[model samples]
Target: MLMNPRVLVIIPAFNEASNIESTVRAVVDAGYDYIVINDGSKDSTLDICRLNGINVLDLSQNLGIGGAVQAGHKYARHYGYDIDVQVDGDGQHDPKFIPLLVDEIVNGADLAIGSRFLSSTDGFKSTYLRRVGIKWLSFWLQLFTGRSIKDPTSGFRASGCRAIKLFCENYPDDYPEPESIATSLKAGLTVSEVPVRMRERQGGVSSIGGFSSVYYMIKVSLAISIACLTKRS
Candidate 1:
């Protein structure tokens, strides 16, 4: 192993004022450094972070989830972090599973995704429609990369140095989680999935809701297909 690797937990928040403090506290309790990207939330997200004395990157305007996450990767690369873990600010991801993701990276995975379907113990598997969309994405990802991922759409993930560098250079701007996996594999990096328990969001609404799920499915499917055909850098 990676004896005492420098790990940074990147939490991207947008209008998650009600949940940011507890989320940061969970990461801190887990004994890891973390930074919250306040993606132009009109709510009191930034204020809560500041009040809690949490490290935060305050963006002036909304950049969506992908852009916010890309910013986190850039910070991880710039600050020389050995591992970067993406944890949602909505409290759905358990910080306890962070160590599992890090362990996979230590074992030589360039990217480690926290998968809910890897085991029966995972508390939540998301909505029925969401699960259907996730399964569709999983099929496409497997067909393209020749690798099967149980939770391709999971936001809770960790990236090694190589993966961080790749994302810093070029990251997907919309619906990134699944596409990023394909991109990393195409770039010849090792990716793995570790079983992790997840929970329903404690607060705030989902970014993808109602009919948007259909649009999200179509968009991410097309993106993965195109990514598979494109030549790797």
Candidate 2:
């Protein structure tokens, strides 16, 4: 059992004004400390957080998802948090699974991912095209790392102290989810996946849409491949 663990939920938001409040509320109700990283949102995301008295880290410029999440990890490291869970501000990631991810960390996983494909949860799987991209990434990740990761692109994840520190020092700039998994594996960290239910985003469009999906797939694939070639620390 994890006794008195200092768990912190790091939410990375980018113009998610319509969804941030309810997402923060769910996290608050789940009884964990949280901080929202406002990644230079053009919308009222930062204002909403401030109005709700939510702890927030407002960046001066947009840093994409990777930079936003990295900032959160840096904060976790500075504050001495034992575990850091990445929950999206778009409400697609359910806060209820935060404990399960934390439990995996307590059980000795360096990183724990909330996977939608690990179970028969309805309405959790993303769109067909997105799933295709996810599957492609998953296959490459498993082939390179010798580990089965059903949902390599999942943003819902928890990291232990070691991972938090590593991520603070080095994290991808774009399409980070899959590349981060490869990095963890190359570093010899134990990664686990927990079955979790997800919901459609309450608001805001995905950053990767239409033609962006093709770009996203190619970019992530190259990132993962390059990460696999780098020497492990």
Point to the candidate with the largest lDDT. Answer: 1
lDDT of 1: 0.93
Query: lDDT of each structure?
Result: 0.93, 0.93
What TM-score against the true fold does each predicted structure earn?
0.98, 0.97
**lDDT per residue as tens, model 2, 102-176:** 999999999999999997868569988899888899899888888889999999999998899889988999989
Clashing pairs in 1: none
lDDT of 1 by residue, 157-187 (tens): 9999999999998788888999999999999
Candidate 2, superposed: residue stretches over 4 Å from native: none
Per-residue error for 12 in candidate 2, Å, reads 0.4
Q: What residue runs in model 1 are displaced by over 4 Å at the alpha carbon?
A: none
Instruction: Return the clash pairs for model 2, or none.
Output: none
